[model samples]
Target: MPRQRTGGFHPRPTVLVAVGTDKHRFDRLIGWLDDWYAGSAARPTMVIQYGHSRPPTIPGAVPFLGHGDLQRAMATATLVVCHGGPATILEARRHGHLPIVVPRDPAHAEHVDNHQQLFARRLGAARMVALCESQAALTAALDAGLAQPRSFTVTADADVQAARLAAVARVGHIVEDLVAAAKPRRASARH
Candidate 1:
């Protein structure tokens, strides 16, 4: 559960990690995050939506969150770390978070294919996400986000809206491509 500060009394910053609801586990991301949190001297209030992955050793971890809860978490979080699911990325961006994205790797059995990596790389090229492909990159990104929270946030409403629309369009195209690519394989298998 996330803690809410009242009366303008803020205690600690919150970091939210969301791994999408795919059946394939994302232990790689969860493991790295748990290790980082354990090693940090001044850990923030952290919440992890672990999904199909094993539960993190961290206290604030949950298997899944309802849509509203996830939105609230994103709205209140100081840093957002998430899998490279387009919807998750878009949601984080909608809340002004330039999310640290770790795309699920098919080589590691984290997803169905390399689509997440491809999409995340494109967004990274466009400066929309802090793409973290390795544990070290993720560590550096986490440190940077905590050190300079404002840098991860989009402050202007116009900029946020523009980025959101662009991302949505790009994601739509990617999803279409994936569907088309799968159709051939599905038809071949049925033959």
Candidate 2:
């Protein structure tokens, strides 16, 4: 069982590695992270949920983690390192983590296809995640990200907030129109 941290106690500059639950293994990411940690002098306290990937020899790695455990780890982590699955990315973002993402390659049998790569690329383009395509890149990203961690805060800009509200209103109107159209018309009674 993974050890649970409670109260206000948390290690500074913690790194959380979540390889996701894809049946296809993501040992590439895990192995590279392990190597990076091994080589680095300032290794922050690290915890990993390896999932289907091979468990690292590192002390803090676990084969899998429950949802609550994963969430708690994310909440306390200074840097989130993860595979490029959409749900994982979203969860990391929800926890205000700008995660270092390494999308699984289908050629390497790390995923069913290249969808994650494409999705990761889009998110990377939007500056939502730090995308790493290779072991070298992952090492560099880990170093840079750990050196200066950035949290993903909801935009404080009034213009961005207003734009989000407008988009939500538009979606609400669309849903209302769809519901109204789906209702059956009542026949008028003849005298």
The per-residue C-alpha lDDT of model 1 at residue 80 equals 90
What does candidate 2's lDDT look like per residue over 20-138, in tens digits? 77678888887888798899876788899898888887779998889999988987887788887666776676566677889889898886557678767877897878899989988
Candidates' C-alpha lDDT: 0.83, 0.72
lDDT of 1 by residue, 1-191 (tens): 22322212236878999998888899999899889998987589998999999999998999999999998998788889998888888778767788899999989998767888988898899898899999999999988877778778754356566676566657745784786599699989988
Q: Which candidate comes out best when scored by TM-score?
A: 1
Model 1, residue 83: distance off in Å is: 0.7
Q: Where does candidate 1 stray beyond 4 Å?
A: 1-10, 156-191
Which pairs of residues collide in model 2? none
Considering summed lDDT, which 10 consecutive residues are worst modelled in model 1? 1-10
TM-score of each predicted structure versus truth: 0.84, 0.74
